[model samples]
Target: TNIKKKMKPIKQTCFDKAILRHRSVIETVFDELKNLCQIEHTRHRSSANFVVNLLGGLVAYCLMPSKPKIPVAGTYL
Candidate 1:
């Protein structure tokens, strides 16, 4: 939502609820990646180490039993 005026009878802009919901889900996933998976770190001694750490974190996330995901409407043949 956007407010166009600060005075009386303020005008407000409309926003899509679906887009906002999707954005919130994306943020939640990133938060989990950075915090729970420890994907964001500054202790890498070399580029290779950083890459390895990133890959490891991704794999760990994939292996987790429960994770946030977007639902698809239909199956594709």
Candidate 2:
């Protein structure tokens, strides 16, 4: 209750809405890396190699940009 009292409410803006909307992409990426990519399931010969690979994969994901959505053209009758 005290924690809630100290917290201030943030005003919702376009940027906030944009961040909330795109938050799922990060969640999806994490889900893919954990479950789909099987990055955690490893059989490595060397600890150093494993760490390097893991870091490299994460860096690649961070460096890669999200795919741009294509806009659909409207037809006028």
Candidate 3:
């Protein structure tokens, strides 16, 4: 089902809630990668540099102490 700004009460089901939660988590990850990890850049000298920057940002993100995670089956890691 399509997500809407004005969601109707009857249309708010368990599946919809789960989908919305997952989307939010994905957005949060991208935001962190761009803002915290410094992945958003436009001054790359070459494709290799761009790849290196992206990899470095991802590695930095992996080393972060706290990360946004979606729970699986009501369990979090």
Which candidate ranks first by lDDT, i.e. highest? Answer: 3
Decreasing lDDT order of the candidates? 3, 1, 2
Tens digit of per-residue lDDT, candidate 3, span 1-77: 46567976465789777877699888999999999999997887899999999999999999999998889998996
Clashes of 2: 0
RMSD of each: 5.7, 8.3, 4.5
TM-score for model 2?
Answer: 0.41
Tens-place lDDT digits, model 1, residues 1-77? 33347746653334455555468777988998999889996988899999999999999889989887766465322
Candidate 2 residue lDDT tens string, 20-41: 6656665677776665444675
Candidate 3 wrong stretches, greater than 4 Å:
1-20, 41-43
Estimated TM-score for each candidate: 0.63, 0.41, 0.70
Clash count, predicted structure 3: 0
Model 1 CA lDDT for position 47: 97
Q: What lDDT is reached at residue 36 by model 3?
A: 93
Question: In model 2, what is the error at residue 69, expressed in angstroms?
Answer: 14
Query: Model 3, residue 4: what's the lDDT?
Result: 67
Q: How high is the CA lDDT of each candidate model?
A: 0.77, 0.63, 0.88
